[model samples]
Target: MSGEVRPRRADAQRNRERILEAAEAVLAREGTSASVRAVAGEAGVGLGTIYRHFPTQEALYQAVIVDRTRRLLAEADRPSPDPGTAFLTFLERIVVHAAQKKTAADLLAGSGVDPKAGTADVSRDMRQAIGRLLTAAQEAGAVRPDLRAPELLALLCGVCLAAERDEWSDELRRRALDVLFDGLRPRPLS
Candidate 1:
C-alpha cells in the first residue's frame, strides 16, 4: 500500500463532529471534572474513537477552544459601519459567552493548556482583526489612539470574569462595558 493516507470517510467525519459537540457540552457542564469516557458516552461513541481522534484531554480542549475562537474571529472580521460600536458589541458577546461557559473557562484556566500552543495562528488572526478595528475607531476619533488590541483583549477577559458572578446581570454587564468603553474614548481637551 502507498504511504499516503486516504481522506476520512463521511461517517468518520460525522463521528468526529459529534464527538466535538459532545465534548463541548460535557466540558461546559462538568469543567475539569469531565473525562474522555464521559465525552465518549455523550457522543454515543466508543472510547477508542475519542482516543483515535483526540488522544488526550488537552488536545480535545484545544480543539474546542480553537473552534470557538474561529467563530469569534469570524464575528470580529465582519464589516461594520461603526468600528467602535462593533468592537464593544464583540466584547459584550465575549462576556456573555464566558458567563454562559464559566465552568469551561475556569477549567481551561487551570488545566495547564498553553494558550499559545495550538491556537497561535487563530489567536494571531483574532488579534490582527481587533487591531484593525481599533485602528479604524481611533482614526474616526471615537476611540483613544493609545488603546491597543492586547489591552482590549485583557480587558475583555477581565470583564468576562467579573460577569461570571452569581449576581451578575445583563444590566451589570452593560454598566461595566459602558465604564470600560468610556475609558477607551478620547478625552476632551480643556
Candidate 2:
C-alpha cells in the first residue's frame, strides 16, 4: 500500500462525525470513565470504526475539547456593536456550555495538558480573544478599569462550578451572572 493517506469517503466522513457526536455525549455524561465500546454503541457503529477514527481515548477526548473550544472561540471573535454586551453574552454562553459538559470540562482541566503544546493553541487563542473583549469593555467604561481578563476567566470557571449543582436552574444561572456582572460594573463615588 502507498504511504500517502487518502481522503475519507462520504460515508466514512459521516461515520466519523457520528462517532465524534457520540463521544461528546458520552464524555459529557461520563467524563473519563466513558469507554470506547460505550461510544461505539452510542454512535450505532462498530468498535472498529471508532478505532479507525480515533485510535486512543486521549485522542478522542482531545478532539471533543478542540471542537468545543473552536466553537467558543468563534463566538468570542464575532463583532458586536456593544463590546460589553458581547463579552457578557459570550460569558453566559460559556457558562451554560461548561455547566452542561461539567464532567468533560473537569477532565480536561485536570488532565495536566500543557498550555504550550500544539493541542492547546485553541485554548491560548481563546484567552487572547477574551482579553481583547475585556479591554474593549474597559475602554468603553462598561466594566471596572481594574478588572483583568484572567480574573474574569477565573470568575467564569467559578460560576460554571456553581452551575453544576442539581438545583441550579437557568433562572439561578441568570441571577448568578447578574450578580457577577454587577461586580464588574464601574462603581460610583461614595
Candidate 3:
C-alpha cells in the first residue's frame, strides 16, 4: 500500500459525525426518546445511514451524551479571572449549554452522564479553582470567607435549576451570581 492515507473511511466518518450531530440537535429540540427518523431527517441523511452508524437508539443516545460531555469539558477549560468568577462563569456557560439540550437537562436528574468531566481529580481540581477565588474574595473582603467549593458547586447547580426555568432572563443569572458571591465574601472590618 502507498504511504498515503486512504479515503475509503472518509464517507463513513462523515456519516457518523452527521448522525451524532443530528442526534444532538434532535435530542436537544425534542427529547431522549426522539425518533431515529427525526434524527435522520435533521441530518438530511437516509434512515439506513443512521442505522449503519448507530445500530440502536441507545447507542446513538450514548454517543451524543459522550459528545456533549466532551464539549462541556472543552468549555470548562476556558480561563477567567479569580476562582469565584471563573467558576460562576463556567457554571453559567454549562447551564446555558445544557438548556439547549433536552437530553442534558434530563441528565440533571441523576443520569449516568459525568457531571464534572476532565480528570480523576475533578473535585480537587474544581475545588482548587473555587478555593482560589474564595481566598481572593475573602482577603479582599468581597465574600464571606467560609464557603466551601463543594457548597459553591451545589449553589451553582441550584443556579442551573433557576436558569432552566421558563423565564430565561440574564438578570436572573446576575442576581443568582450576586447572591452566591455575597454569602461567599468576607464581612468588612468594623
Candidate 4:
C-alpha cells in the first residue's frame, strides 16, 4: 500500500462535525465540567461515536477551541466596506467567544493541555489582522490616531476577560461594546 493518507468516510465526517458542534454548545453551557456523554446526547450520537472521534475530553475541547478560533480568524480576514465596523465586529466576536467559552478554557487549563496549543501561529495572524484593521480605521478617521495595535490588543484582552467573568447577556454585551467602540473613535478638536 502507498504511504498516502485517506479522507474520512462521508458519514464519519458528518458525525465528527456533529460531535464538535454539540461539544461546543455543551461546553459553552456546562463549562469545563461538561462531559463527553452530555456531548453525545446533545449530538444524538453514542458515547462510542464521540470516543471514535475524540478519544479524550482534552482532545475534544482542544479541537473545539482550534476550530472556533480558526472560524473567528477567517471572519476577521474578510474585507468590509467600513473599516471601523470590521474592527468593532472582530473585537465583538472575540468578546462573545471568550464569554461563551470561559468554562471550556478552564477545562483546557486544568487538563494539562497547555491551553495555548494550536494558537501560537493563529495568535500572530490575529495580531497582524488586528493591526491592519486598526490602521485602516485610523486612516479613515474612524479610530483615534494615537491608538496602537499593542494597546488595542491589550484592551481587547481586558474586555474579553471581563466579559468572560461578568457573563453579560447579548444585549448588555452589545451596549458595553458600543460604549467601548465609541471611546476608540477620534475626538473632535475643541
Q: How well does each candidate superpose onto the true structure, as a TM-score?
A: 0.78, 0.83, 0.62, 0.73
**Model 2 ranges off by over 4 Å:** 1-4, 9-11, 103-119, 164-167
In what order do the candidates fall by lDDT, top score first?
4, 2, 1, 3
Regions more than 4 Å wrong, model 3? 1-10, 78-81, 103-153, 165-167, 186-190
> For candidate 2, lDDT tens digit of each residue in 5-27?
88889999999999989988887
Q: Put down candidate 3 lDDT per residue, 60-145, tens digits, no spaces.
A: 88777766665665655555456555555665665666556644343333223354442223334443544565566556555566
Give a tens-digit lDDT track for model 4, residues 120-141. Answer: 4556666777788889888888
Report lDDT per candidate.
Answer: 0.73, 0.76, 0.62, 0.77
User: In what order do the candidates fall by TM-score, top score first?
Assistant: 2, 1, 4, 3
* Better lDDT candidate (1, 4): 4
Q: Which regions of candidate 1 deviate over 4 angstroms?
A: 1-4, 7-11, 31-33, 102-116, 164-168
How does residue 87 of candidate 3 score in lDDT? Answer: 52
The candidate scoring highest on TM-score is: 2
For residues 62-154, could you state the per-residue lDDT of candidate 1 as single tens digits? Answer: 788778867777898788998878877766676777766553233223223356577656656655766787788888888988887657766
What value of lDDT does candidate 3 attain over all alpha carbons? 0.62
Regions of model 4 farther than 4 Å from truth: 6-15, 32-37, 40-51, 100-116
